[model samples]
Target: MFVLWDADGNEIRDEYPPVDPLDILRNPENAAFNLDTIIGRLKELGGSDIVALHQLAQNHYIVLDASTKDGRHYIVRIARNSVTSSTSARISNIRSYVRIALDFFRINAPDGIGSISSFKSTANARSGEPILGPYILPSGLHTPSNVFESIEEYFRWLISVKKTSTTVGTTKPDLDEAQVTLKKLENLISESVSGYRYDAELLRGVPSHQDFSGHNVFINGEGLITSVIDWEFHMVKPAVLAADYPAWIRYNGTADPRFVDKTSQFSSYWMAGPLDAKRLRQEYDAVVKKEDPEYHRALKAGTFCRMAEEWLLSDVVDIGCRRMKAWLENSLE
Candidate 1:
């Protein structure tokens, strides 16, 4: 579903449309190169507007018009200090993230999140729905599970690429340790778990949004989570990561130093900080436990270490990397 918020932070919820973006781009005249054209096109097909576009990512937001069915428009994101070369890649990357995210939410995340829309064949080739997910509503699709692995893969990819541009990682760092840490973590994931099947049940069961950060998430005055926006970073991944997301956000009182550095420079550009990671974790855990107690413990077992290892080796220093080292070193004591 789409979520619309006004200047006063008041929200309006509506069904999401299932139109192909490429179709509009293909025939600009049909879209009339304007907002109303897009809205009319959305309604022509069986779609609804969820939210008016708002500012998000580095400098972008979705736009909405009251004349439309759900009063929603396109998701507009802007970037800073971007070049023509990088802009294409960045936009392309965001689109890729969206596909993976849709899969993630559909296959792994819990219900009541965002809907996964289909891409137009005329649109970019990368835009394809791997799965429609467990349920497809007239307005949108639902995430069957909460956590998933596309997130892990995304983090792994980010950590592996120390620098996306020439400007990344100019500061002094122990490169040797980073490499070694990554190796260890990879080994652990490959050998430690019986199989990655444990995440099968926890993931959204199709695909989902990977950018489930604090800022993308919204809560009403009563403190209930109302919405999560920004589909640019969405992707297809394992569902377990979505399930454990609330915990990671809530108990972030003491995050790994490496994660701090990474976010400070890159990811946190659009992150919302006021989220209560601890309380959110508690709530997430309670909900999962109520659903299935064993499922909760499974998230803690190998998955936690694997995630930590991935993070440790990821950008350099992670809570998991540090904690794993301590545990191993202290085991002899």
Candidate 2:
């Protein structure tokens, strides 16, 4: 069975991507490009009498609503700051990437684990579906990401980071305590893997959307998805950080349901988080349980699994270590 985007939504393959229906804007020069590139491409797509709608998001992209000569309509997004490089070889490779990933590259493509515009056979590679590097590293893919190739490699890397982080602490006593807590968490996961086959579930990558929410979803009257925008941070990640639903549902592996009804009299789509979003989340889960049950299980488990990295690497020692200890107790259960 084909794994759908939103349970019953259409399949988005990395190999054969359907066109604009979605359109991405690009400039090869590192310096910013203008609307001319977008307008030229729009005409190529057979859209004329182009109408530039008011800007949607600040400093992100310009949205254009246009009509074809044959009386059809189109919604086009001219995104800014597409990645390019001085290297001719790398530019040659990025010219032909999938318009969308919507998957973990399981359908006849290598695992995509690098920058979207990086040199590669595909653009889906963005850190092996997990947090691959130390939090301080200031670089992206080197020949499609200079990171580990397997799950076990990342485990060992984290263990090594525990030492480096402590050294950075030098005089702080808290570093010693943090080392102990990190080791305890690692051992806890190891024991679970040996006895309960937990790691077996995370052996492969899974699809993750950067902004998985009601706002990014575009659908037709019949409820078929026209396109999923915001693939900028969308990725295929290790199953632990996998998110096949709205990001706020299991945000940062916190696993708490979060929603705010900001609907105005204007329209449901024109809000910060969308009006009645929590209701929509509940409805989305019900649909998933029927159409994609396995993902539903991950929906709950991912918070705990994903929180390990987030709590340890991204949080304060005082709160992160204490919260992580409690989290481990529940996860071991």
Best by TM-score: 2
In terms of TM-score, how similar is model 1 to the real structure? Answer: 0.41
| TM-score per candidate | 0.41, 0.44
lDDT (C-alpha) at residue 299 in model 1: 47
lDDT of 2 at 87: 31
User: How far does residue 148 in candidate 1 sit from its true spot (Å)?
Assistant: 14
Model 2: clashing residue pairs?
A: 112-124, 112-125, 113-125, 113-126, 114-125, 114-126, 129-237, 129-238
| Candidate 2 lDDT by residue in tens digits, 81-118 | 22222333222212111112223423222243322333
lDDT values, one for every candidate? 0.38, 0.40
1-333, model 1: which lDDT tens digit per residue? 243332222333323333222333333343212445444444553366533322222212333323334554454222121111232333333333333333333343223223344543536676554333322222222223332234344344434543221222233354444355556655555444435555545533334444455445554333334456776545443445443443124223224332344333223333213343344445545655565564455445535543543343233333323433443334225
Q: What is the lDDT of candidate 1?
A: 0.38
